[model samples]
Target: MPFGGKARWGVRSTVALLAAITGLFLAPATVPATAASAKQSSAAKALAGKYVPVMMIRKQGENLCDTKVEQYQVMTVDALFGNPDVRLMRNNGSSKSTLIKQAPTIDDVRNRGEEAYIDLPGDPLGDTCVYSKDFTRMKNEGEAPVAVYAHIAREKGHSGIALQYWFYWYFNQFN
Candidate 1:
């Protein structure tokens, strides 16, 4: 009966581990929609047309075995369906890894928004590089960038770290 008991215990432990991993993959609905976010939504609604999505990914420094990878994407919204629905395409600075996320909340463009993000290391093999960049700075320098709904974000977990990535939204006077 001791062998039976050990097997049962192993099964229970495996179940518990799976449960915990599943929860980490699920995103919570508690992401706050603040009052300021509401204001920005209104402004983004005004620019709901066609814009382009342009992006570039490169290693900020020497491509060390453990260096972080930096990705930059820009989207131009021009009022499709009187709204923005453009998706972005991206690579992992090497592979054709594709991810599709949601378009900006109207509030994003209204607030004249900007975002700076750092993607922590994901893999334990040291094949992935750290992620960091200034979304606004790239645009301010006239990069003619556009946003992609796909690159907006997705939850990723590895090496005991969880991270979220999303697009930065903005509007220009179309000079």
Candidate 2:
């Protein structure tokens, strides 16, 4: 017996024990059902009845384009789904665009606009929720400008809101 039968058996037994112990530590954790439900309820409440912008117009700083207008219109996730609950947010050089009356395809966006800007909701006391499409899906689809939206929401038992970026599109074209 190479290393003696007893010694080999002892080593194997030790390895088996270590593997079992490791598996216990690596097992998936489970959240309490009550806690999970509470969290879901809070998220639902936060998202209820909010209006998010569907179209955006961003000012061209230095990039050259053919359009005489300084700003270009681009469609957003809110515009595509027509979600009335989440409100559209804008920054200093940004605003909702009246040009884009409906959801646009990737080619349509690329042909007319440079970029679309969607202002993320900012809450000093709460958190924000942002959503976007998975990168893998985007890559598989093609090169396009994509838009995502986030919600400023409060977690269950928490005072501050959570920022959640929701995935909406597979591809968005710019340039």
Candidate 3:
């Protein structure tokens, strides 16, 4: 009775047949590794022992809603992990802010040979800031700040190769 037609196969059956065919062609196969796959595997093997931790802070010229915030000086992994000169300070406010005295550079992240951590601050309205790293720039331009971290992570066995697409907007006026 569906579609008010006399067709031999129903809509559901046609859709299922098409979906199964699509899945068969789209799923990854283990046999016959391509050159790109080989390269990714090699890179993953090379990055099996390093890790990096990063914290995001307000860059100069950003609005801070008139809140009193302390600026930290730039710090390296050695200065933060090896030396005892700097200490982490925590605030008792509702935000429970952690004061970081320095932000790590992309190069600092790449040169790290051990485990790492990343800390992104929460926005003023309580929305959390999400951090992601991609290699699109490196693939196209041979380099990018975030790609350094992604490559290192791949080299250290911390993550695997993946393709991602991202859309960014300058402002979200509608929330």
lDDT of each: 0.29, 0.32, 0.28
- For model 1, the superposed segments whose C-alpha errors exceed 4 Å read 1-60, 64-101, 106-126, 130-175
lDDT of 1 by residue, 43-137 (tens): 23222212222234453343333234433333333321122233332345654544322343433334332331112122223334222222334
**Model 2 bad stretches (over 4 Å):** 1-50, 56-64, 67-141, 153-175
What stretches of model 3 exceed 4 Å from their correct place?
A: 1-41, 45-76, 94-147, 151-175
Position 78, candidate 1: lDDT: 30
TM-score of each: 0.15, 0.21, 0.19
In model 1, how large is the Cα lDDT of residue 93?
A: 60
Question: Where is the poorest 10-residue window by lDDT in model 3?
Answer: 11-20
User: How many angstroms is residue 168 displaced in model 3 relative to the true structure, after the best TM-score fit?
Assistant: 22
Model 2 lDDT tens row, 1-175: 0011122223211001111112112323374346655565444333421322233334344422323432222213324333222232222355544334233443334434344433222332222211222322223354223333344444456565544444343223322
Q: Give the true-structure RMSD of model 1.
A: 21.1
For model 1, the local distance difference test gives 0.29
**Model 2's TM-score against the true structure:** 0.21
